[model samples]
Each structure stands twice: as C-alpha cells, then as structure tokens.
Target: MTTAERIAAAPTGTETAGHPGPLAYPAARAAGCPFDPAPAVDHARREQPVTRATLWDGSPCWLVTRHQDVRDVLGDPRFSAEATRPGFPFLTAGLRELITSTSSSLIRMDDPEHARLRRMLTADFMVKKVEAMRPDVQRLADDLVDRMTDGRTSADLVTEFALPLPSLVICLLLGVPYEDHDFFQERSRVLLSLRSAPEEVRTSSDELFDYLVRLAESKQHEPDDGIVSRLVARGELDFEEVANMGRLLLIAGHETTANMTALSTLALLRNPAQLAKLREDPSLIKGAVEELLRYLTIVHNGVSRVATEDVTIGGQTIPAGEGVLCTINTANRDDAVFPGGDTLDVSRDARRHVAFGFGVHQCLGQPLARVELQIAVETLLRRLPGLRLDVPFEDVPFRHDMAIYGVHSLPIAW
Candidate 1:
C-alpha cells in the first residue's frame, strides 16, 4: 500500500493493526486536551488496543488503551515501574533514565517503594486536611478576582491567578517563601509548555532540584510544621528524597491544577448558560469541580507503564516488558461509560472518571487540587458576573503538543 493509502486506510476512532510507534502522536499539530483523544484511542481500543511502538531511537514499547486494560496493568504487580531494570521500554534513552531514576520521586516508583514514599504525605493531603484549607483557598481566589477587576478588560487567568494560587499554596504547605515562588512557577510553566526546548525542561528540572536541595538543608537546621518538616523530623528521607517530594509538590501540585482550572473555565465560558447557572448558584461548586475534571481531563499524556511479567487484559496479552499508555482523556469520555461522551454534562455524575487516576497509585494530592479548583472556578463566576471571552473561541491559544493539555491564555472581559 502507498504511504498515503496506509494513512488513509488507517481507521479512525480505533487503533490500527501493527506497531504504529511513537510517531503516532504527530507532535507538531497534536491537539491538546479539551478537544478529543477518544477517537484515536477508541480506534486503538477496538482494534489493536494493545500494540507495540518503536521509539524514535528504536526501542519497542506497548501502548495500552482500553479502560479495563489500563486499570488491570496499573493494578497488577507484574507491570513494574522500575525503569532501572534492563530492557525497559523507555520513550527515549535519556528520558527513560530520567523518568526511572529513584531521584525522580513518587511518580516513577513501583509497589512497596511507591507506597512507602507516598504514605509520608498522604495523610496531610487527605480530604479533611484539605477541607481545613477552604478558607485559605477562598482568600487566594478572592485575591485573584480582586486583581482581575482593576481596569483590565481581559487578563491571562493562567498567569495572574490559576498558576500562582496553587504554586503559592503548595509553597506555604512546604514552608517555602512566597516571595521566591515566581521562580518555581515560571520554571514549571516553561517545563510543561509544548514549545519549550528539551534543554529548557532539563534546566527547569535542575533549578527546582537545586532550590529543593537548599530548602532541605535549611529544614535540617530549622524545620517548621510543613510537609517537608515532617520528612526532616523523621530523619529517614535523604536530601534527594526530601527534595524529590518537594519537587513533586512543586510540579504536580500546580501544573495539572493550573491546566484544569483554565480549561474548565474555558469550557464553562463557552457554554454561557452553564456559566450563568454557576454564577447564579454557587451551590454547584462541588458538582462543577467534578464535571470540570471529567470533561477536561487536562493531563492528556496519560500515565505510562511497562510490564515486568506477561499480563493479559481485555483478552489481549501485553508482553512481559512492553510500555502501556492509558488514555485518561479517552476513558473519561467512553460512550459505554459516559452515555453521551462528547457532550459536557455538568449535572452528570462524573465521579467515575479517572481525572485524579485510579487504583493504588491514584493521586495523593487530589483533595488539595479539588479545593483550589472549586475556589477558583466558583469565585471567578461570582466575582465576574458578566465574564465573557474577549476573543473568539478559535482565537484562544490551545496547548496541544505538550504532555499537559491546557490553554496558553484565556482572554476574557466582564
């Protein structure tokens, strides 16, 4: 078949046969979230849902798609996250090593190691602990709203507020100086921007580590009552481990929350009736948060995993050492799961969605993220009663190529 014919013959909304490889994503024009990933993932799920892909540098990996498949792989102990082992199907040699390193923090660990590190902070992030943060979240939200009405017709909500609120909140939780937060916020933003150079991401990661190293050293001398202080108090976590946790808090705490906040706002604004409904009745804040998380699934490049032993999911076999890519975006929109997958139904029960993920490795900071989002979205509606986009929907900058699916800027006016 001609290359064009091969491309044409490839079915839509399902995975085609054989190993399509990493080139499948089409990075340059890859549409980020708040659009649709289900089509391609659905195609994969229905056909060759579990297939191998050759990395650009020529390593092979499997991409797992179906809902049950993702859960099974993530739930099973055989699918190891220890990329340190040989024959691991890494995206690229450098990234594989970078992602798999023990120094990389909670995201890469598997089983006992993952459980041990995550438990240290899980209690602090529990819903009750996060609920106590409501007042603080409200204050931050109000402050951001207060800043928006000062003669600016439209503001880049992502920067002036969405980004800073979580960054500042996490810093406070870690006892880091608020004044020094811009560096963390900026680097995190840059690191996630799809357009950024690889060196930029590596540098940003290094800068965060450097900052954490200094902060951890200080905590050793004079620890306070934040999460980091607890790690220091136990004297069990090494500087790297503590810094890794700190870095995790800095990156994970803000990046996904920021994207979700902005994307959900954009989604709501596009649907004026919904926006008006939210504005008129702030009681829907909880429902709105779930709907937003479900409909948006802002963290687009769903988590990756590699099988340590052969595993079977949905009647298909994933070889003992192949990578798996879960489509949170696709799974959240599955027609079988969500009756009308494409439509945004705020009133619908979105709890079943996998925005914060599922299984043993679900997000530890989900409660914290919820409070921040609820405050930001609800507060924005109440404060900006006449909020409307200053530019047309198409004019808005959509972040498509990056790992995180979000908007670059949402220009709105009251």
Candidate 2:
C-alpha cells in the first residue's frame, strides 16, 4: 500500500497524533531513547515513511523518513535548498531572519554558484590533503588528552578535548588565530542554538560576519596558508561573499565535528561491549566511526529543502512550492536498510549511512572530519584505558535545544 494510504488506514492515537497535530514537522525524541530518533520518527518510518508534515511556521510539507525516499528527495535537483524560497522549511523564525538578512553562502546557493564557491575550498579538505595532516591531528589529540587527564581526576570532555580539537583544526585551516577560538565558539553556540532569542541570534550573526569581514580583508594584504587566504587571493568573489563563505566554514567546520566527538564517545562508554571490541582491535576504528554516526545521527533535524516541481514518491504527490524535510535521523536509523539498526554494532558495514548527508551537498569536510574523529577516538581510548562516565548516564545533559544534538558537558573519569 502507498505510504499515505497506509497511514490513513492505521490505528489512531499514534505518537504523531499525540502532538500539536498529526503532521507536526519537528518531533521530540523518546524520553528514554535519547540516541534514537523520536518515537514519531520511528512510527513514520514503519507505517508511513513519506507523509505530510506541518512545519514550524504552520506550513504544510512532506516529511520523508525512509532511507531511499530521503535519498531520492535530497539527490533530485528539483528540490532546492535556498532558504529564501517561498515554501522553504525553516526550523526557526530566527534562522529564516538570519539567512534573509545576510549574504548567502555555499550552503544556501545552488550549483554552479555552489560548485564555484565550493571548488575554491575543496582542495584543502580533499582526502589526500587531509590525510597528510593526520600527524598533526594525532599530535593535537594527544596533547589535548594529556592536558585533560593531567592533574585532574575528572574532566568535562566536551570542553576539555572534544570541543578544542576541531576548533583548533578549523582555525588553522581557515587562517583564523587559535587564540580567537573562544570568540567564535561562543558566537557559534548562540547562532546554532534553537532557543536563542531573536536579538541574541541577530547580534551573534552580525558579530561573526564582522569578524570574518576583517579576517578576509586582512588576508588580502598578507596572504597565509589558510583556506580563507587562498580564497581571498583567488579574487573571484567579492568581499561580502568571501566573508560569508568564511563564516559558513568557520561555524560548520567545527560544530558538527565537535558534537560527533562528544556524542560518539558517550555512545561508546554506554555500550561497554562495543567499546571493549574497539579497544581490542584498533583496526575497527573506521567501521566503528560509521556505526557511531549512524546510531547517533547527531544532526537531529532533517536537511531542509523546498520543492520546485511536482514530484511523486512512495505514492504521495508533492506539489511545487511545498517544503520537504528529508529527516536524516530517521533514514539512518531505518531498520530495513540496517539490520538491528537501533543497536550500536561497531563492526557493521555502515558506510552507506547519511551522517555526512548525500548528493551534491554531501559534507565537503567528510575527509577531514573522518580523520579527526578517528584520531580523537583512538587517542582517547588508547590513552585513558579505563575511561568511563563520571555522572550517571541519565544525568548527562543533552543539547536538545540546539540544531546539533550532543552532550553539553560529558564528565569523564579514568
């Protein structure tokens, strides 16, 4: 049966119906199942993987939950990512306002503009280039672990090691001084926060833009071996575009990786058997990373898209101008695609997971992110042989209010 038909015929009082409405776009995670997607997401995947949904602004759209359906929506060019589009699904009014008020970056633009701008920065994140930096990444990971474990029986892994590794790496990659990490990190938190006040979001965005503007301009006069300096030297993009690009890279580069580091570590600690297996065989690190990403799928929100043409998928017709929320979290957790999907099995072949997303907009920094995560995970377990959570797993604070999902402060003791 078609997904919509199935949903309509199914029993009532499902989690979807218990909400503000049956089609609420943003669903909440199950109380005890913090790592899994919301019960609503799971319900959708099982009974009606592609069904109608109501966005935050009371706009109706299609919520795609199945793995292949999400792939179809995201990979198809008819679906646009432009935030300025009339029916684009925005998570918050603050985010919509921020996008409209500022110059668009690579994430907001479609190809060939997206391709052109992305081309300017791709060289730095290419697998070979990032692979060559493994020594540096490993060194940084070791140094942070040394500091985190030294003179302290316990540490907030979020701030001590997880947050700093990627922040420092991105700073070096972008030519921004490592000393200014606190400045950007705080502003980024405000910007990514789902609960930030409108004024706070606006101020943080403007401040970040202004900082990038100065940094990009300075690079013109004095070139450095950073991504921003190289883009500035290219001279193809204007000052505003360059600054926006820098802002996008700076915020996105670190935030996602940082969250993954912290969350993945927490997941491992919780799954002691998996942690022991990984510890026993260092060769499993690559597959373990993929499994953790699939299990956590930290980017809780789907990658938003606006339909530009009428399309039919899973027997539901999505008309032009409607929004589509390709719920990645659900797709990754899909039981059909990955057997025993909810359970974390580090040795599973999870290479097909969409944790980095898919299609042309797939994460450009996947290579760098993979390298950093591998090093960080390996170093943490190798260095702190008896690492475990200091606080009760239930007591660990989660970033449910932020666009990215992760632990706020993971207290660790070895």
Candidate 3:
C-alpha cells in the first residue's frame, strides 16, 4: 500500500451507531507513545481542516496542517520564528529560551536580521563547500564502522555510529574544541528532550549556555578556521551571540541527525529490499535519505511561531500576538502535497517535501548532514550486510513525548 494509504489504513477508531470511541487523551498523553503523537493531530488537520488546540503549555493555539497552508505560513512574515509569545509549545519550557535566545542566529530571526546572519555563515554550508568536506566525512564514517567490527555484535549505533559522527562533523564545521564534544553532546541531548521534567530541562540549558560562552571566549584569540572563527572575523556578533549560535548548532545539528539515523536504520531494516536497492546503487542514497527524512519526520516537535500581525489560515483568524504552529510532521504527511504521503518510498520524489523549512530560513547544516548520512548509511550497509535488530520490535525503548523523535538506545546485533 502507498504511504497515505498505510496511514489511512492504520488503526483509527470507528464511531459506529449509538457508540462512542475512546475520549481523546490530553496533550501530555502525547508523551506516552513510542513514535510521534502526530497521527491524531494529522487526522484533525485533515478532517477538521482547521482546529483549535491546547498547547503543552496549557495555552490555546491554532495548528496548521495542509501542505500549501504550511508553506504559506512559513513564508509569511506575520508568522515569524519568535517562539516566546503566548501559546508557544509547552513540551519543554527550556525550548523557549533555546530558540528565542538565538536572536542573533539566522534561524531565529526574520527578514533583514536573519538574512544578515545567514550570509555570514553561507560559505560554510554551501553545496560546493560541503562537497569538499566529503572526503573527511567519509573517512569519519568509515573509521566509526571499522571500530564496530567483531564476530559477536551488539552495539548502540546511536552512540557508536550515529550520534558522534554528526557532532564530530558539525564541530569541525563550527571549530569547537574536540575535548569538549562529550560535554556538549550530553547537554544537547537533554535540552532536546522536551518530555523531561521542566526543572531538569532548565538546569541542563543553564549549564549548556555557560559552557558555550566559555568555548566562545577561547575562540577569541586562538581563532581556528571554523564557523565561530569565521563569525569572529566579521566582528558583527557579540560574544554572547557567538555562544548562542554555538549552542544552536550543537542542538539542531546533532539532535535531528542522530534521531533520524536510528529511525532511518529501522525504516531500512523493515524494508530490506529497498535497503538492498540503495546498496546496489549508491546514487539512490540521496533520494532515499530525503524519503526517509520526510517519511520519518524526525522533528515531531511543532515549529511554533508568533503572529507579528493578524493573519488567517484555513479560515481561522489568528489575531496579532497569537502563537501558530506549522506542524511539519502533519504537513509532510498531508495527502494534498505528497501522493501516498505516508509511505517510505525510497525512490519517491521528495523534492517538494518541507523537511527543511522553506524559503530563507531553511536548514543551513543540510549539506553537512546529507554528507554525514550518505557516508554513514552506505558504510554501515556495506560493512554489516546482515545487520539485524537485537531486541524485539516492541521492546525498543523510544522517547515518545519529546520534541525530538528518537530511541533511548538503538540496540542492534548481527
């Protein structure tokens, strides 16, 4: 069956004559599942067209779902990436500070400011620029796999393969000190887990911000040839801004890539024939990755934006100062844009998928990530052709209630 069909075919309650199905669980119950809690949300997005919902923060908000509507909202200046307004997601209070704090980074700003900051970092993530780093990325991927060798096998690929690989590459791009990688990785993971208690999340964010400032200070004199150093060259951003940028990269670059890596592996393992197709024709890897990215929808967390001005989408009026969420997971699965939108079609044309935010604020780390996944997936399949899941399918431990969709540990044995 096609993707949309699969999702449509998946279990949804039937309200038969004189009978009512289960009352819907509140948003906190969203954290109780192993995958994204988007199926219900997507159904609402599609069936009700436009609906009102309570955010995790217990504030009212409008959820946008159809692909065209999502695209329009993303491009609309009214819906800016200011996540601190009323009705922002309550999944993790720490995320408010995490996103809004980057007032200086391109991803967090709008128009001129966002453009200025993005221009500063443009050369580093350009397709040609990242292509040059292809050799280095490949070497890192190969080395990680080489160490994973042993006749008897059980390894947490997230740690041994997926997690470190991106951090190493992103650090290289940003010029972070290698010694501080573990420290940075731990805090990044905790900060991205929205399902955690608020106090713990706040504590981790405080510590991470402090750590980033120190790292930024060290870059002042002994500026290396990296992203921070390049930004330092411009002399436009203040020290705090630089540190915040570092924190942003540390969080966005590593968190999403790691989650998708584990999830993609599961996707491929479940679709062995498609995995073999990718193995035989490495060219298929790129599209396969995009397909997996769209199919997986790793950023299960909704992208919250505040309305700088009044706007209407899908017949609902969002007044000035209201918060709006463009549910990427829901939109990506919308049948309107993606025919068979829910299937994991390795060869599917995912060109229009908005896994990367559209327009000016699209993901800058995309090229680097593409290279990392390209190398990582190709190397893993080539080296461990018989790689299989060690644990029972249902036994896998995953964080269902987090902004990032990922497993606690991706346990596997061949």
How close is each model in CA RMSD to the real structure?
3.4, 4.2, 5.3
Clashing pairs for model 2 are none
Off by over 4 Å in 2: 1-21
Give the poorly placed runs of model 1, Cα more than 4 Å off: 1-23, 26-34, 52-58, 86-97, 100-102, 193-198
Candidate 3 lDDT over 29-52, as tens digits, reads 233344434566766666654455
TM-score of candidate 1 against the unseen true structure: 0.89
Off by over 4 Å in 3: 1-37, 87-89, 97-106, 150-152
TM-score, prediction 3: 0.88
Candidate lDDT (C-alpha), each: 0.73, 0.86, 0.72
Q: Please tell me which predicted candidate would have the highest lDDT against the true structure.
A: 2
C-alpha TM-score for every candidate: 0.89, 0.95, 0.88
Give Cα distance to truth, residue 111, candidate 3, Å: 2.2
